[model samples]
Target: MRISVKLASICLMLVLLLTITTPAFAATTNPVLSVTGTTVAPVASVTPTTATAPLMPGDTGTVVVTLTNTLKSPGTGNTTVITESHQNVYPPTAGSGITTTRQTQTSSSDGSSGACELKFVNLLSEGPIHVQNAAYTDVGYLGLGDSAQFQFTIKVDDSAADGKYYLPLKVKTDNDECYVNQVVPVVIDSTQPRLVLNDAPSKLGTSRGNIIIDVVNYRSSGINSASVIPEGAEFTFKPRAEYTVGSIGAGEMYTVTFETSSKNATYTGNPSFVLKYKNGDNWHQTAPLVVGMEPKTDAAAAGNGGGDNTLLILGGVILVVLVLIGGVYLFMRSQRSKK
Candidate 1:
């Protein structure tokens, strides 16, 4: 009975020893192996920047495009399970003991793993828009949360109408792994105010005379900084350089007068007038209007000549009457003396 009790105590101690040492052996024998999973694809956001909106036709400017990688680091977790079995004999006794142990350890990491490679970037020109620069190639890699900027020079054709236009943007990666095709919108504004010369002086006298001109705005929009510039080869005009008319509303009419005199008595050259105004932020001038100016020198000279001739004729008649009356008085005196 004493032997049985001692054996039982010895077995209990062996079991406790095995339990403590088995965990330490398993920890050293097994190591956590990290297995990387598939990486998430990168998605880029594109933003375009322009200097001005509603650009006028025949304008040149730059377009800057920013590409941002919006993808984040991938999350990963790894788990390792270790199973160990051991057999132990305490005192070479008939009864032996067997022990089994299991250990589990997990390791994880949430970090950046992937990047975006841009092989080519291009901005294509469409109708009435031309690209002035070459396409970009081998732009390089962009990691998560990374961004890049590309600048392009562009020009709008002079014949482009007033409307909205789209420019195609092409982005590509190696072996066509990632491709993106998008469009950027641009506005074209080519509207201009229309000005017409309604009326102008048809004749000018030799002396200082008034040159009246009627200006009419034909457009529905208002025109600012309205002015008129008169040009003549044979005449000198008031406000020799420019005549400011201020502003004119839609479909409005404004009359301006200039004091002018002919340089010579006969003006054979044609006179012209130009209308200058501003639309939005651009200044425009209309084609010169050739106005006919007839000089009144011939009529004035004829009237003066006729008046001088009439005065001479009246003087001659008075002189003839005086001479006849003198002769008659002298004859009557002679008759009276003879009587």
Candidate 2:
């Protein structure tokens, strides 16, 4: 009978222990849950525009770049949340108490949509070109299907060669997560129009004379609104100081004439001519070309042969008058002797 009673107690204890540990085992086996949300990054396009004419050596100009956000939808950021739990149970009896423990964890993420934040924009100088302005910082945000323009002032070195040059443009956004690097092309041309004296009189007399000059365009491009001006110390140009030559084409030449008169007959000085023309939207002037002019005497100013002939004829007339007077005096003296 005592054995039967001990067996019953043991079975009852086993049942109670199972009932208390079952919930703990179930809690320990519970699976963790995770959720995530993601959005695509924004895309941007860059385009550069230059002036109508190529940049001349040692010239200062501006370069314009247009930035467009090509993304149809706004960008979104990621967010996450985590949760955890623990459970412990102690057995109801004995020298060493049994322990049961359970742990649970969960995670979730959320995203928000909006414009793309641009951190900075920079233009890097290369070769003979130099950027005058600093990098653009804290450029604000760019929305979907939106465009922005940025202009940079640049100067070309005087020794820059004539050819195509590329400059690097860098852009950063989304806390430097997104980056863009592109090359912008530009042309450098140092050629300009040249003016030279084609045909001119060696000596300008007191009388008015024609001064002809040749306008030569050495550049690979055409120029318009062309004009020429005459400069001298003792000369006056007619009909105007500024003579309009209209247009000159690439590798072409145009001839212009000016009626010039000397202010003083004895003046001996050098005269110069200047050429002005518009290349694209910019006007340029060439260095003055100095020409020497020698003064001429009045007799030399006239026909050389005619002046010599006039002087010979006057000498002959004086000789004939003197001979006739001498003959008359001799005739009077002879008449007196006869009386």
Candidate 3:
């Protein structure tokens, strides 16, 4: 009877211990996260989505990025993924020019959107940090019953150089490769003319001096060379046309180096002929060349040497008219006396 009672007591103790420790063991053995109290079910996975236009030019309207974290398991905390920031803007690159890098604090929600204009870059002061880059701040994982989504939008630099710009975004979860790279093609465009004359304005003379034309790619792809028209002013050689850009890509500046023969035309008015290139469309702009001519006659030569003679001659004509008027008055007075 004593043996029986001792065996029964041992069995009872084991059962009691199992009851107490079973729950604790189960808790310890469970995975890091557990869905308790509520039912757990699987849902559809989230596939990445890309924008129609990877990026928007400063001149081209606006770009909006819609990130759908459609995963059923909502993340615990919201994450700030920076698509682009001119400066350290937590979100997108501010349209702000180089004078001031776009900052998250200065985003459209707070500051004026005009601050993001790309035209204000300080080319000489200090260049903006270019190429592609990305980062993520402290954020949380998806919670059991919650969801998080972020909308990324930014104004592309209208003047942004054309290149393969790679933008990567980091999703909060490490389980899946959440990084998605969006290859953005930046197109160069401008309402203003792209071809500009960098040649010194003072160097223009009646004799066609060497003219340097800096050509910018506003549309389509890069131009290999700009084929000029006419034989006299614009030719392939003699002046030796040189371009800053030999192999120009989209959003690039190519320079044209060529010289003109001395201005030998009869008329001395504005001598402007259209600079044309048949890349695809008829691209043309009036080349700004100043033609200086030495006058042939002594009077014309003297006029050139002195202040504007045209104004002086007008003043002299006015003086002569006044003297004639006075003489006519005196003659009339003498006739009246005689009468």
TM-score of every candidate relative to the true structure: 0.50, 0.59, 0.27
Where model 1 places Cα greater than 4 Å from the true spot, the runs are 1-121, 136-152, 156-164, 171-180, 185-191, 198-202, 206-228, 243-258, 268-270, 275-284, 290-339
lDDT of 2 by residue, 1-339 (tens): 756865655565555444221111111111111111111111112222422346677766567767766655532333333333332335554333454544444443333243567778788898998888998898987765566777777788878999888888888877444456777776788788887887778877668888888899887657778999889878888856788988888799998888887886656577788998775445678999787677555555467769889999999999999999999999999999999
Tell me the deviation in Å of residue 294 in model 3: 19
Model 3 regions more than 4 Å off: 19-66, 74-136, 139-185, 188-267, 271-339
- Superposed by TM-score, candidate 1 places the C-alpha of residue 307 at a distance from the truth, in angstroms, of 6.3
For candidate 1, which ten residues in a row score worst on lDDT? 35-44
Over 223-293, each residue of candidate 1 has an lDDT whose tens digit, in order, gives: 67889998987888887877899889867888887777778766667667789876544466878867766
Tell me how many residue pairs clash in candidate 2. 0
User: In terms of lDDT, which candidate is stronger, 1 or 2?
Assistant: 2
How many clashes does each candidate structure show, in the order listed? 0, 0, 24
- CA lDDT of every candidate: 0.64, 0.67, 0.36
Q: Point out the higher-scoring one by TM-score: 2 or 3.
A: 2
- Candidate 1 lDDT at 184 equals 68
Most lDDT-accurate candidate: 2
Residue 222, model 3: Cα distance from true site in angstroms: 19
Scanning candidate 3 in windows of ten residues, the lowest lDDT window is 116-125
